[model samples]
Target: MSSANLDQLHRSTLGVYESLLDQFNPGLQRLVALGKTYIQAFQALSSTSEEYFHALGRMGEQALHTLSSRSLGDVIIQIAESQRRLTNELDGMFRWFHSEVLREMENNVKLDKDFIAGSRRRYEMEVHNHASALDRQQRRGHQDVVEYTHFLRDSQKDALKEEERRYRFLAEKHCNLSLTIAQLMNKMGGALHQRAEEWGDCVNETRASRPRTPSRMEQMGMREEERAQQWTKREEPSLGRVPSRGPSPVLMRSRSGSLGDGLGGGRLMRAIVSCAPSPNPTLLDFSMGDAITVLVPEPRNGWLYGKGQNSPRQGWFPASYVEPLDQAPRPPLPRGTNPFATVKLKPTVTNDRSGPRAPGRII
Candidate 1:
């Protein structure tokens, strides 16, 4: 072919390759965009979790300011709505990515199995050539060997090593690629199956178009019957059941006034509980695990004293000696000072024993 014609043919081939690559580029871009969206959504979810906790803290602050009981419900509803929105956003993002990116990537990305086989065959041929060269070197005549023995042996060894290395490297790469593609396919297939199952139950009823109904006597009677059945199950005694006479004769209590029912105080061990000012506080720093020296809040004879807390030890030190590290949080102001400090806290009252309500929630 003429040089001009050859150059033109080369350009045309390059264009064709580029066009083939371009066919998958849009899908690849969409996959990238989906990943970015998930990351952004995840970040937003993290921020939302922090804010939700902050809102709960604010509810604690507003506990004393109740105009009516309904206000608490409103606050709870708001918290629920925020959580629901975050969950829905995550669900939508997952669905979109699964359908548009992962599924397409698995189902449509054609694997060239023949190329892998071809590479393996070529690698084997190369290795066979190296073995044959080594054999030929070993059989060479002594007269020729005297002049070129070292060079021939070295050349044969180097060539064999290079061939073996290339073979191993190619084989490993192919295996890894195959495993990755298989894992991706499995994950995509599993997710698709799970989603299909969930969608089956949803029954295609959109929120905007679903019908609402109020039932009469039959519904109420059915609910009452269900409740009665549930109640009866608790009331009924099992045939093999052994009834306890009364409260245990043995008293089981820890030195810390805790009921040691397998719920040991291991968490308390090596833990320095600090009374820090609220707005924001670093809860735990894994990086500073043992290095963290904190000032724990103690109700010292009802005066509230915070000193350096060596949690592993039984007692605390003087507040003066225990310096509040810059990283350590300041003590939370007394609930008396902050009216909103204890608002909207879940009523931590247990029905096991009846008593007057206690002050502030413990961690």
Candidate 2:
């Protein structure tokens, strides 16, 4: 009875495990699908960003081109205008200083004249009463003149100091403005250089990674005929004529069918692989120069579902990897050969290891 209960419990546990797995599988597939979608979206965004940068670079180049076409006279005119403005500002400052100095000197001279006149009047009025008053007035007048001369000298010195301070301030301001302009120009130059370098690198990388497109002749059909002829010549030295001797059975069979039929039918199409793919359940791993069949002509998220012609296995591959055969010229088949032939399979050997070997017989 205990053994029976254990068996029942074991069966129940297995049922639960199976139920959990059934629920998880659909969710897992959804997650994988979402991941693939995200990858494709990210790739598109990256390509768009690259194109935007390219456009910005082109605009910068165009601006430089326009600047190159401008005349040197225009630059000279701009410099002249700036110099004229500076000169006008300096002239205004000097004029203000000159007017201030003139006004101050006039006031000082007027005060001196009034004081001298009052002393002369007093000396004249007291001449009869006191003869020494005349001498004293003369001495006072001399002292006042000396003091006025000293005051004038001091005023001139102060004016000179003020002028020096104003000139120093202007010089310092001009120097600072010049330094700021130089820094700004340097930054602009550096930024332009960096952007140009990035654009150049991007262009080089794009050229290296992108496959070269076939020329007009190759695309139109002339090149395909030539390639087909070359392939035929390489494969068959004799141009469809019966050999002098009896031809072998293999030779009797047309070899033209081995090469793919022309890309006429919608059901059949050929492509040359340009890029390799990583291992994925939906995608096939293919290398460069490999030929593949397009099961679906249109792409889904930049990926195409296809089968390798040589491999004959179906899977998804990047659309960019293969060029469609419809664009190229199709080759005509030689006369008297089936366009489609059955692929031959090698006979399989049966191993009888399951049965006991008789003595003296090789196993």
Report the alpha-carbon TM-score of model 2 versus the true structure.
0.22
Misplaced by over 4 Å in model 2 are 1-145, 182-192, 211-363
Candidate 1 off by > 4 Å:
1-10, 18-65, 72-76, 106-363
Return the TM-score for each candidate structure: 0.23, 0.22
User: 1-363, model 1: which lDDT tens digit per residue?
Assistant: 343543354344344334334444344446546766765777687677767766764674465265432334344444545454545555555555556545544443333123334434554464455545656876783222232334333434543454455346435644654565566557555665665555444433332345435367656665656665564456433333112221121222445766433234212222223333333222222211222232222323222111122333222222222222434643443322433334587768656545555688443
Q: Best candidate per lDDT, number? A: 2
RMSD of 2: 37.2
Q: How accurate locally, in lDDT, is each candidate? A: 0.42, 0.47
